[model samples]
Target chain A: MERRSKITPILLLAPAILIFVFIFVAPFIYLIFQSFWHYETSYVSKQVFTLENYIKLFSDPYYWRIYWRTFRLSVISTLITMILAYPISRMISRMPPGKKGLVTTLIALPMIGGGMIQAMGWMTMMMPYGAINGILLSLGIIKEKMTFLGTETGILIGLVQSFIPLMSLPLIASLGAIDPTLEDASKSLGASPLRTFFEIILPLSIPGAVSGMVLTFMANLTMYVTPSILGQGKIQVFGSFVYQQAISVGNWPFSSAFSLFFLLIMGVTAFLSSWITKSIQKSIYKGNEA
Target chain B: MKKFSMFLLLFVLLCVASTVIASPAEAADCNWDEATCEILDGADFGGRTMVVGVWGGTIEEIYRKYIIPEIEAHNGKVEMLLGGTSDRVAKVYAERENPTMDIAYTNMFESAKGIKEGVFEVPSADAVPAYADLYDVAKIDAYGMSFAALGIAYKPEAFEGEPDWPDLWKPEYKGKIAMSTFPGSDSEGFLTIAGYLAGGDDTTPDLAFPKLAELKPIPLFFANLDELFMMMDKGDVVAAAVFDSYTRTYIEQGANVKFSYPKTPGAIVTMDTLCIVNNAPNRDMAIAWAQMSLSPIVQEAFAREIYFGPTNSKLVLDEEAASKVIYGEEQANSLIRMSTYMTDHRDEIVERFNREIAED
Candidate 1:
C-alpha cells in the first residue's frame, strides 16, 4: 500500500516536473553555458570558453549605470505601489463580499488588459498633445504642454499603474485575515486611529505588504514593454538593453552574459529582502510581547 | 533487305523519342527574357511552404500582390515572417544550419554581413536570372529589392523652405529634432552627414560624435513613421532624419510633413535587399520567389504603392510615379552612401549611441 501511494504521487508529479525541467531548468542551464561562449553575432555563438562577454559588461560604465538605474527605478516604483495599494487594499477589505470581488476585479483590470495594451493606453494619454496635456493646458495649469512620454516620470506612471494590482491583492488577503475586533479592542483601550494603525494594524499587515512589495519590485526590475514604449528609446532598462543586444544587434553571448548577471543579482536581492522582512517581523513580534 | 529496313526504322524512331523526352528537361530552367523578368519554368514545389521573412506593412502588400501569388501558381506556398530587418537577420543567422525561413528581406548592410558570414546565399546570375536586370548599385552580393534615400522629413510650418541637414542645428529647433534609433540606415546616414558637416567624410569620421551631441536633449527617437508623424503633427518635433519612402507614405496619408533632399551632400542612399538563407528547406521555391520579387511586376507594384524605387533596371514607371521615387541611374548615383566602416564598427557604435545619444 505504501509503495503504491508513493508511485501514484510520482506519476501525478512526473508531468509537471518533466515540463518544468524541459522548459525552465533546461533553458536556464543553456543560458548559463551560452553566457560563457564567444559571440560571432546575435544568433550565432561559438562554444569556446571565454569571459569576454562578462569582461565587456564589467569594464563598461554605461552598463553599470543601466544596472543601477534599473534597480533604483524598480525600488522607487515598488515604494510608490505600496503606498497607493495600502489604502485601496484596506478599503476593499472592509467592503461586502460581492462588492469586494467586483472592486478587486476592477483593480486587476490593468493586469487583465495586459502590459502592452496598458503601456499603449498610457502612451496615447501622455504624449505632448495627448489627453493629459490637453486637459491640463485647457485648465491653464501650464502655459506650455509638458513632455511625459520620453521621461522617467512617464515610465514611473506606467510601472506604478501596472504593478498596483500586484501589491493590492496580497494586502487585501492579509488585511482580510486580520481580526476586526482587534481594531475595536485597541480603540476601546484609548488608542487613537493612527496609534491603532501603527501599533496593531500596520504591524499585522507587514507580511502582506512585504509580499506585495516583493512582487511589484520584481515586476518593475524586469520590465520591458512599459520602459520601451514610454522611454521613447532614451531610457535603457535591463530588459530593453538585453533585447537591443540580442535581437537588434544580434550579440547573443553578451546579452546572455548580461542576463545571467541580472539573474544572479535578482537572486541576491530576493534573498536579502527575505532576510530583511524576517528581521522586521521578529522585531515587531518582540515589541508586541513587551 | 526487309531486316535491314526494319532495323533502320527502329533506330530513327528511337532517336525521335529520345529527343522529345530530353528537350523539355533542358529547356525547363532557361531564363530567356532580359527586359521584363518573368518566372522561369522551374521544378514544381510539390505544394510545400516556403517561409519568407520581410517587413509587414505596404512592403508585404506589394509582395502578396506581385510575388506571392506567382509562387502559389507554381505549386508553392509562401509564408511571410514580418518584422524589422534586425529580427529577420537574427532568425536567418540562428537558423542557418537548418533554416525554416527560405527567403528574407534585409537592409544592404545586414545582407552584406550575412553574406560575409555565409548565413545568406550569395546571389548568382545562374540562380536568379533577374539579377542581371538590376542596376549596378543593386548587385551587392544579394538581390536589391528597393531603394529609398535617407533625407529630412520636416513639418512645413516649422521650416521656411526645404531644410538642409546643418539647418537642423538651428537653436530654435534644438529639442524639436527627433532622431531614429542607432545601428540603422537612417541614424548612420544622419551620423555620416553630421561627420560631413564637421568637415570629415566617412573615411575620416572622427568628429561625428560631437556634432550629433549638439542636437542633444533630443525630444524623441522615433522607431516608426506613425510615432514620428504624430510628434511632427503636434509641433513637438519640427524636423527629423527619415527615409523618403516612409515620409512619402505618411505624407500621402494626409500627414502634414514634407521630405527634403538636403543639398551640398545630397540624400543618402539606403537599399533594401532580398536574401536567400543558406541551407534553406525550399531552395527551388526560394529561388522562384526571388525571381518574382526581383521582377518588374513586383518592382512596379512597390513603386506604385509606397514609392519604393525599383532595383530592377528593366522596370519603367510613368512620369508621375518616376518623379516620386528614385527613378534613373543619374538620380540613383547622386545619393551618397557611407563605406563599410559603419558596418564594421556597428556593435561599438551602437554602444556609443546608447551611451551618448540615447541615454539622458
Candidate 2:
C-alpha cells in the first residue's frame, strides 16, 4: 500500500513531466545546438560547428546598441510599472473582502483582453489624429498634433500599460498578507501613517515588490508586439531584431546565436536581481528580529 | 465454409469492377489543349486538396470569395495558410523535407531565393499553360501572378506637382516622408531607385546606401500598409514610396492620396509570384491552381477588384481598371527587373539598412 501511494503520485506527474520534456526542454536543447551551426544562406544552414555567428554579433556596434536599448527600456518600464502599481495594489489590499474582489477584477481587466487588443487600443489613442491628440489640441496644449506613433515614449507607455497588472497582483498579495494589527499598534505608539508605511509595510512587501519587478522586467525585455506596433519599425528592440534575423533575413543560425546571447544576458540579470532582493529581505527580517 | 469463402471473393471482385467502371465517368470532360477554355469550363480534380501559402487581409478575402469557390467547384479543396511573404517562405524552408504547403505566393525576389535554395519546383510551361502568355518581366523562375508598380504616394494638398523619386530627398520633404523597412519589397524598390539616382545600376548597388543615408532627418519607417496610409492621412507623413495598388485601394476608400509613377525611370515594378513547392503532396492540383491564378478571368477579377496589375498578356481590363494599374506592353517593358541582383545581395542590403538607416 505504501509503494502504491508513492507510485500513484509518480503516475499522476508522468504526463506533466512528459509534456515539459517534449515542449520546453527539447526545444531549448535544439536552440542551443542550432546556435553553434554555421549559416550559409537563407534556408541553408550547415551543421558544421563555428563561433562565427557569436563573433559577428559581438563585433557589431549595432547589436550592442540594440541590447543596451532593450535593457534600458525594460528597466525604465519596470520602474514606471512599479510606481504606478504600488498605490493601486495598496488600495485594493485595504479594501473590504467583497469590494477587493471587484477591484482586483477591474485591475486585471486589461490582461483579460490580451496584449494585441490592448496594443491596438493604444495605437488608436496615440496616433497623431487619435483621441489623445484630439484632446490635446482641443485643450490648446500644443499648436500642432504631436507624433507619438514612432517614438520611444510611445513604446514605453505601451510597455507600462501592458505590464502594470504583472507588477500589481503580486504586490496586492504581499500587502494583503501583512497583519492590519501591526499598523494599528504603530499608530497607537505615536507613529505617523507615512512613517508606519515606510518602516513596517514597505519592508514587509519587499518580497512581493521584487517578484513583481522581476516579472514585469523580464516581460518588457522580450516585448515585441507593442514596440513593433507603437514604434513603427523605428524601434529595434532585441526581440524584434531576433525576429528580423530569423524570419526576414532567414539566418536561422545567426538568429539562434542572438537568442542564446539574449537568454544569457536576461538570465544573468534575473539571477542578480533575485539574489539582491533575497539578501535585502534577509537583512530586513534580521534587523526586525533585533 | 467453402461456399461462404466463394461468396466473399465474388463480392470483392464485383466491388473492384464497379469502381473501375465508375472512374472514367468521374474524370473531367474538357480538352486539355485549350487550357484557358478548360479552366473556364472547369476540370475535375479527383477530390484532391491543395494547401496554399499566401498573404492575409483583403488578399485572402478576395481569394476566398472569387478563387477558392472555383477550385471547390472543380471538386478540389483549398486550405489557405495566410501570413506575410517572409513567414510563408520560412515555413516552406522549415518544412522542405515534407512541405505542409503545396503552393506558396511570394514576391519575385523571395521566389528567386527559393528557386536557388531548391525549395520551389521550377515551373514548366506544360504544368502552367498561362506561363507562356505572361509578360517577359513576369516570367521569373516562378510564374508571376500579379504586379504592383512602386511609386510615390503623396497628399495633394502638400505638393503642387507629383514628386519624383529623388524629390523625396529634397529639403521640403525631410521628415515628412514615410519609408518602408528593409527586407520588404518597398524598401528594396526604393533602394534600387536610390541606386539609379546615385549613378549606379544593379552592378554597384552598394552606392545606394550612402545616398539613402543622405535623405536625412530619416523618414518614418512604417511597419505595414495600414500604418503607412494612416500616417499619411493624419498628415504625419506627406509622401511615401508605396505600391500603386495599395494607394489605389486607399484612394477608393477616400484617403485623399495620389499615386504617381516617377517620370525619370518610370515605376519600379514588384511582382508577386506563385510557385509549386518541391516534393509537394498535391503536385497536379497545385499546378492547376497556379494555372487558374494566372488565367485571364482571374487576372481580370484581381485587376478589377484589388487593383493588382495582371501578368497575363491576354487580360484586357476596362478603362477604369487599366487606369488604376500599370497595364500594356509599354508599362511592362518599362519595369526594372532587379530580382537577380536583389536575391544575390539581400543579406548585405538588409544588414546595412538596419545598421545605417534604421539605427539613424
Candidate 3:
C-alpha cells in the first residue's frame, strides 16, 4: 500500500518535472554551455568551446563591478522594502476583515498595473521640473532644479516602488496568523509596546520577512525596465549589462557568461536567506522546548 | 485509496497535456490569412503569406490604406509586424535561422549593420524594378532602402529665432530641450551635430563630449516622436532633431512645429531602408511585396499622405511636399553621406557619450 502511494506521488510530480526540464533545466544547461564557448562574428556561426569568455569577464573591472553593484542594489532595495513593508503589514493585520479588501486593493493596484505605465508616471513625477521638483521649487525647498531620473536616488526609488508589494504580501499573511493572546500577554507582563513588538511580533514574523527579502532581492537583481527607463542607461545593473552585451554588442558568449554569473549571485543570496531563516526557526523551536 | 490517488494523478497529467495541445490552434484563429484574394478575380496566392515587419502609426496607416490593399488586389497577403527600427532588426537577427518576417523596413544604418551581420539578404535589380528610379543616394544598398537626414523641427512661438544644431547645446536652453530616447540609432545624428558644434572633427570623443555635454540639462528624452510632440504641445520643449515626415505629420495634426534644414556644414542625415531575410519562407511574396511597397505609385501615395519622400525618382511629388524634403540634385550634393568608417566607430562614440555627456 505504501509503495502504491509513493508511486502515485511520483506520477503526480511527473508533469512538473517535464515542465522544468523543457523550460528551466534545458535553458540553464544551454546557458552554462554557452558561457564556456566563443561566438564568431557571424550571426549564426558554430560556437567554439572555450573558457576565455569567463576569464575575460572575471578579469575586467567593468563586468566585475556589475556583479557587486547588482548584489548591493538587490540588498539595499530588499532592506528598504522590508522596512516599509513591516509597518504596512502590521496595520493590515490589525484591520477588520471587511475593510481589508479595500486596503488590499489599494496596495495591490501597483502590483497588478502595467509596469511600463508606472515607470512612465514615476519618471514624469521624479524628473527635473517634474511634480516633485515643481512642488519643491514652489515651496522654496530648493533653489535649483534636481535631476532625478539617471541618478542613483531615482534608481533606488524606482526599485523600491516596484518591489514594496512583493515584500508586503508575504508579510501580511505571516503577521495575520500570529496569536492575539501573545501580544496581550506581553503587555500584561509589563513589557512596553516597543519591547513587546521587538520580543514578540518581530521574532514571529522572521520567516515571512526572510521570504520577502529573498523575493525582493531577486526581483531587484533581475530588474531591467524600471532602471533602464529611469536611469537612462547610465546606471549599469547585471541584467541590463547582460542584455546590452547580447542585444547591442552581439557578443553571445560574453553575454552567456554574464548571465551565468548573475544566476550564481542570485542563487547565493537565495541560499543565504533560507539558511538564516532556518537557523532562526531552530532557535525559536529550542526556546519553545525550554 | 492508493488506486484512487494514482487515477487522480493520471487525470492531472492528461489535463495538462490537453491544455498544451489546445493553445496554438486557438491563437491562429484571429490572425488568419486568406489563401486566395477575392479582389484579384479569385487567383490563389499558392498558399503563401508574406510576413512584413515595419514601423507602426502613420506608416502603419499608409500601409493599410494603400500598400496592403494594393497587394491584396494582386492576390497577395501582407501581415504587418509593427515595431521600432532596432527592435525590427533585432527580431530579424533573432530569427535568422528560421525567419518569420519575409519583409522588413528599417533605418539605413540598422540595415547596414544587419547586412554586415549577414541578417539580411541582398536584393537583385530584377526583384526591385524601382531601383533604377531611385536617386543615386538611395541606390546604395547599405542595408535596405534610401537614407533621410535629421533636420531641425521647432516651434516658432517658443524659439522666436532660427536655430541650428549648435543651438540645441546652448546652456540657456538647458532643461528646456528634449531628444529621442534610443541612442544606438540616433547617436549618429547626435555625433554629427556634436561634430558641427565642435568644428567638424567629430571622430575624437574629446572634442565631442565637452560640446555635447552642455545639453546634459535636457529635461526629457522620449521613446517615440509622439511623446516628443506631446511634450512640445504642452510648450515644454522648443525644438528637437527629427525627420521630415514626422515633422510634417505633426504640422498636419495642428502642432505649431516648423521644419527647417540647418545650413551648418555636415548637418546629420539619417536613412530609412527595407530588407528581406536571407532565407525567407515566402521569398516570392516578399519580393513582390517589396516591389509593390517601393513602387512609384505606392511611394507617391506615402509621400502625399504619410509625409515621407519616396525613393523612386518616377514618383514626382506635389510642389509643397517636394519643397519640404531634402532631395533633388543640389540638395543631395550638399548633404554628407555616412561612411563605413563612421559606423565602425559607433560603439566607442555611444559609450563615451553615455559616460561623459549623459552623466548628470
| Recovered fraction of real interface contacts per model | 0.65, 0.58, 0.12
Tens digit of per-residue lDDT, candidate 2, span A64-182: 88899999999999999999999999999999999999989888999999888998989989987889899999999988988777688999999999998999999999999999999
- In terms of DockQ, the best-performing candidate is 2
RMSD of each: 5.8, 4.8, 11.9
Location of the lowest summed lDDT over 10 successive residues in candidate 2 chain A: A227-236
TM-score for all models, in order of appearance: 0.89, 0.90, 0.82
Model 1, span B182-235: residue lDDT tens: 777888888888888889966444688778889988888877888888989878
Query: What's the best-to-worst order under TM-score?
Result: 2, 1, 3
After superposition, the stretches of candidate 2 with alpha carbons farther than 4 Å from their true spots are: A1-5, A140-145, B1-49, B73-76
Ranking the candidates on DockQ from highest down gives: 2, 1, 3
Could you say which candidate leads in lDDT?
Answer: 1
Residue B181, candidate 1: Cα error in Å is 1.6
For candidate 2, write residues B187-210 as lDDT tens digits: 878888888889986556678888
Query: Which lDDT tens digits does candidate 3 get at residues B108-150?
Result: 7667766767777765566655555567777566422443566
The top-ranked prediction according to TM-score is 2
Q: What TM-score does chain B of candidate 2 reach?
A: 0.86
Better of 1 and 3 by TM-score: 1
Relative to the real complex, the DockQ score for model 2 comes to 0.57
